[model samples]
Target: MTITIPTGDLVGVLSDVVNFAHPKPDGGVLNCVRLNWDGEYLHATATDRIRAGISTWHKDDEPDDDGQDDLFSNWGGADNPWSILMPLDDAKDVISNYKLGPKEYRVPLTIDLHQGVLKIERSRDTGHSRLVMQIQGVLEEFPDVREILANNDRVKPVTGQLYTAKFLADFAKVRARGPLQLAFAEGLTHITIGKRFVGAIAPLPEDRAAA
Candidate 1:
């Protein structure tokens, strides 16, 4: 089955989540960006256990005239969501190509998933060349990051707590559309970047934070 995502939206989602993805050698499944489609919104998420990043893209209508194959049917039912894990390198490549490629050549990317392999195609108008790339999807199951993302509670505010500076700084890489806000509490530090991206970073123990 195949689905189309807007060029700018793809780049935005990738940029927001890529930094949170861990390296393949160390993190295995955590080194991927999970792409989920629920018949409306397409979400991209990644985490390195300590911190996470998430972004969403909405599709109102199908872009291709042929209609292609139904993503839901290929998986199960419309109510059941479909997801695949893309490598961190592929996510970075997409972002880099979009930024460095000719502006006029930028077009919506078509994602084709089949038989354990995932393919992405970017086609240019008329005389321009098309770019197609394929890579294997990681078969390992991704951790339940939703559980971590939902535990953010700032009700009992705290101060002077220690957090890893590197984790806090990853939020800045999100390229948020609006102001980035951080809500500190006793446990996790909730991060909100614009309206579409959200994340959380675990606080470090004072002993470890000082090192």
Candidate 2:
């Protein structure tokens, strides 16, 4: 199946994922972006075990007259979603190096996922390019990030102590355009931007919070 994502949206989601991805001292899959394309929407998530972020974008609608197979016709339901875990650096390079057309209003990227690899391709009247990136199969699953965000209600006041001030600041910077909410509960810091994106940061240890 071919999945097309706009350049602007692709860049935004990738930037957030890369920013939140944390390196592990033991060297593992924690430093990668988990991309799930469920036919209609593409979900990108990153987590450092301490903090996590999820970004989503919908696929472009096709015209009824276009006699092409529905990109999502074979999309197995959410229960069996197609996903690929890609290294943060490769994802960044693919987006940064994609060339946009001079007359194109929105640059669209086509991604082909097969055999644990993602082949990203972009074409314009001016030129075309393709990038193949290896995918780390679902070995170390990403934390239950959705459940973590869902449990933290945003309407309540934030009470948890700040753990990583720099992380909070960086996350705030990425979603700076919209109103950001910081909520704390059960030793976790929840950050929300508008209604689409949500993140969680683990609070500092009791000793550090007291200090």
Candidate 3:
């Protein structure tokens, strides 16, 4: 299956969530970016057990089905959402490679998934490819982070928890040009950066936060 997305949108969503991925090699599925295509929106999420970041890019046009090349045939429906856990290294490679050459922000990026391998490519012309990278998708199941977020009430504070200022700074790295908005609940802190990016951070224990 092939999914086409705008270059800038893909890069921006990856950058917004990639930093929240687990930094250690032993983190397993936590060391990946979860890409979910839900019919109209492309959602990216990453978590390190302590913190999580999520970003969404919306595609305005409803894809038309033309038999073989229909992007919506295999996935991107209410019942069959497309999702994959891509390694953190592969996600970073895509972001870095997209920025290396002459900026063609208008080009569309295509992602191909076949047999267990995922291929990402950018094209300069009809037949000429500009940047390409491929890697196998992680086989482990990503945690149901949406359930975690959904359980919290964004407007009401359930409990107060403290967080390390150093770790909290991670949310600041999101590509937001405006002031960041932050809210807190019992155990999780909700962060909103600009419009499309949102983050969740678990608080440290009171004793640990003081230390």
Candidate 4:
């Protein structure tokens, strides 16, 4: 299947996902990014068993030749999303050095998945670039992160805690420019800049009173 998305949007999402990818010491799949398409929205997710990040982009409304509303009709059913595991380094290079031209209105980066390989292409009137990389063969499963996020109760009042200064700085570099919200719950702290970007990090352990 071929998926095309705006260069800026793709980069923003990828930058956030890469920050949260910490491989498990026991050799787990948390080191890679999971790309999923449910025939309507494209999602990128990464986790380290403790922290997680999820970024989603809805496909633009473009009618196909048959007057169909969805562009990914043949991709897969909503119940069964099409997914591929991309190594961290490869996923970073996919968007590295990507810059929109001055006259470019909306340059698109196209991802083509076929035969266990993923091809990424970007082109403009001035220049073009492409990268082909192999997807991870091991189907180490990813947890249903979205389900966990949705099930959290938002009615209870949440208390604010001091996040690591270093983490706060790092988050600012990738977070979308605007007001931000932080929520702490169930030993995890979630930071959200907008509806498009969400990231989770483990909260610091509570300090014990002096004896």
Best by lDDT: 3
Residue-level lDDT of model 3, residues 1-211, one tens digit each, is 5777756667878988888899777999999999877767888999988888888876553212222233432323242356778999989988887753234443467776666677887766523457788878899989877788778745655445677686787777777645788787656788887667777888777777566
Candidates 3 and 4 compared: the better one by lDDT is 3
State the TM-score for model 1.
Answer: 0.79
Pairs of colliding residues, candidate 3: 159-186
Write candidate 1's Cα lDDT for 1-211 as tens digits: 5777656667778888888888665778888999877766778999988888788776642222223333332221143456788888877887777543334322457776677677776766422468787877788889877776666564455646677677778788776467888787556777887777788887887677667
Error of 3 at 176 (Å): 1.1
Show the colliding residue pairs in model 2. none
Per-residue lDDT of candidate 2, residues 102-202 (tens digit): 33324555677777767765554323454444444555666667886777645446445747778766686553435787777665777877655778888
Show where candidate 1 strays beyond 4 Å. 60-80, 100-106, 152-154, 208-211
Model 1, position 131, has a per-residue lDDT of 76
Quote the positional error of residue 50 for candidate 3 in Å: 0.7
Among all windows of 10 consecutive residues in model 1, the one with the lowest summed lDDT is 68-77
Which one wins by TM-score: 3 or 4? 3
Local distance difference test, per candidate? 0.70, 0.64, 0.73, 0.62
Residue 124 of model 2 has an lDDT of 45
**In candidate 3, residue 180 scores what lDDT?**
88
Error of 1 at 97 (Å): 3.3
Deviating ranges (above 4 Å) for candidate 3: 60-80, 100-103, 126-129, 154-161, 177-179, 209-211
